[model samples]
Target: MRRPVPVFLPALLLALTVLGIVTVRLVVYEFGGPTARRKAVTVPPVDGVRITSMTVYSGRLPPCPEPAFDDYGHHDDPVIRPLPTGGPGISATYELHNEDTEVFTYTIRFMFLAGTIQVGAFTDEVVRSVRPGATVRGTVRPETQDPYTCPVTRVKVAEVTKVPDSELPPPPERCPPSGLRLTSDHTAAMGLRVVGLHLQNCGTDDYTLDGYPLLELLDTDRSPVDGARITHGSGGVSGISLPGSGFDEPAHPLVLKPGESAVSELAWRTDTPIVPYLRVRTQPDAAPVTLTLRLDLGTTGTLAVSPWKLPP
Candidate 1:
């Protein structure tokens, strides 16, 4: 009788242990929540605010498409001023701050509200792009006005955000008008001469060009002309002068959204006839772009802007 009691107690304990294991498994495996992992990423911060303080928002000239008037004695002319003020109307500026994991480019525009009538409000379609972790500034003003005034009344930021891809707007199909063929302290033409390459945002967005090309005239032998110089009269080449003079013109750096292009000009002259190729090198921040231009004596012509294709 004693041996049977001990056997029965051991059997009962084993059965109880098995039952407890089954109950715990059912509760944990079938009823518990899910367990999955995800990757993490960080993004920077950006801020834009309306500037009511008149002191900081002083007016200035908007950037020109091209400073080098490559095309001379051609039908190419700067976009004439339409308003009573003689230009795109107003001058405005905005402050932009970029905060993010990677470097970024921010584009901003201001719209003028004049008694509910918006007249001649323009954005920086070509010449301004901000970088990441930096503050960017932009201006909008009439090109042809004296004492250049800011025509807009109320200024609002058109866009203040970061773009993922580098490409914004593609270069426009129509070449941007290279401003005046001449850049002298004196003046003759009544209006502004639009210059530089224009790009379009065909890619459904906008982008910016680093800057205008630093044009160096190459001789027939494909070498940079050491002493060759360019000169222009008050009214441009239209009011000419001597030979072999080089005009040291600055290319206007600009930003273009989709359907936009950077426009610039090359107003230069040489004593010797220049049928040689015009070698173009873009700014440092931009990709190295080079192009061969065909020069025709006695004619100021427009140079078209295209992407630089490097060989593999």
Candidate 2:
């Protein structure tokens, strides 16, 4: 045989060449080589901002209020009234800033933890670019729920930047503590005239009074009134100049602290005739639990059964 001419020599050479090429590529890439530099685009860091203030308005139920729309259809900051009664309608305002170079979108929402659980959400227009030192204002309208112990209701930021998850600080606390009474005449056009008691300084440091007291009429036995139109008196705290329905409005929204007591009045008239006293219950947002008033009509316009009177 022409002597396999040491085939190992050729094989060795090929292996050496391959190793050299790989080594060169590794060294080049390790030090900012053109091939490595032309790879994927760089993503800058993203920054976020928190909301400074939020407000809720007062109103009735069913169709709640919405944030005002600008001529361009963009939403504007809302002016909320305190302690909106009836149903769930809240107006929230937020101030935010983005230190990142990219555009971001923010979502605002509310969470009701106690009594009932619900998430109230609203969206803001896309933010094209929040420069390293720029600020933006936003607003959201959240639906309210039926009267219940919404003591832990709060506003939060649900989203920011391109990130799918984000949250904000908890909202201030509100303790709606008040008393109410109801009287029924069964003969007036206005079936029920309601009066309220605003317990002053009955809330925590975080919240203030938003609206007058609230009163609800429940059957002696427990049944929800689906369609009830109750009116309140125009009178303030001094003395009730009660409405025809006899329901007077509290002069100021009651702010009760941890252990404080206040008295209020409410009245209503029903078409159904009864012989025994009616059960009048007061349901507030927070403390002072629920108080029930059992009134015995002594054939005249006066209270026969009150907490002061004990049954013998």
Candidate 3:
């Protein structure tokens, strides 16, 4: 038995030497609960957006956005321990180097890989208001609930979708009892952008408006946009000449009763910073209502507003 052991030891040493034996170290990472052997998350060369920092939690498998891709088609792997309360987690800070000459909003998709094979996938995350020259910082945790046995070794950006920031939908709001609700309609053609602010009389009282809306543009952070020149008509705002845009309409006193509405126009050039919020007052002293207009207004430095008028 001793002779066999010696022979085996020599064979093992020979194999190790052929494998180019080097000092081996175990890589353990802090995952908030325990140290894990997960690899450091890596981001490949991606345009527009990059992951600046990432933290991955193992021992708890994350549920993929597409459950069809998640493990256990009713069959469990031998290594999957039933996680009573915890699962894997991942949080990443995304730095969008917009490098583009235009402002953009990005939607990123992520997947978890184990040894070159994707073990899970997650929902897409939308990061808004990424202006030119690296302006916005968004943290994405595209995670879900599940218990996976395979350690999340790497994270990969599966897909990325980008759109101009001016095109985003306004924040959703229900018609309130203030007898008024404001919304927007967006249109773009030949690089000209137009947003129609729709004011509806949702309550029983009559809401009256005259002339143009009192306007204030805001950045994504809700701060006033500096150097914004909001003109009263589209004449100097870039698209006032478009047919049926109503920027040329003359302002007159209008009354909106219940079930009635009026539309105001906002126009700007496509080359602009993201104006995500627009503070609107039907009158100079009326309560200000902020709409998520996504107006392409900052870069070009000019915005045009039309008075409340009947919709075309």
Q: Local distance difference test, per candidate? A: 0.35, 0.35, 0.64
In model 3, residue pairs whose N, Cα or C atoms come closer than 3 Å (at least 3 residues apart or on different chains), thus clashing, are 60-87, 60-88, 61-88, 61-148, 273-299
Question: Which lDDT value does model 1 have at 157?
Answer: 50
Off by over 4 Å in 2: 1-47, 56-89, 103-116, 119-128, 143-152, 163-312
Q: Which candidate model has the greater TM-score, 1 or 3?
A: 3
TM-score of 3: 0.49
Candidates in order, TM-scores: namely 0.26, 0.23, 0.49
Q: What is the lDDT of candidate 2?
A: 0.35
lDDT of 1 by residue, 209-297 (tens): 45344555455444666544333221244322224222223234455554443434343232235434444434444322223233433
Q: Candidate 3's residue-wise lDDT over 155-263, tens digit each?
A: 6676565656443433445556466777777889997787888888877888888899988877755578888788877767654756766777688999888889998
Clashes of 2: 30
- With candidate 1 superimposed using the best TM-score fit, by how many Å does residue 221's alpha carbon deviate from the native? 52
What TM-score, to 2 decimals, does candidate 2 have? 0.23
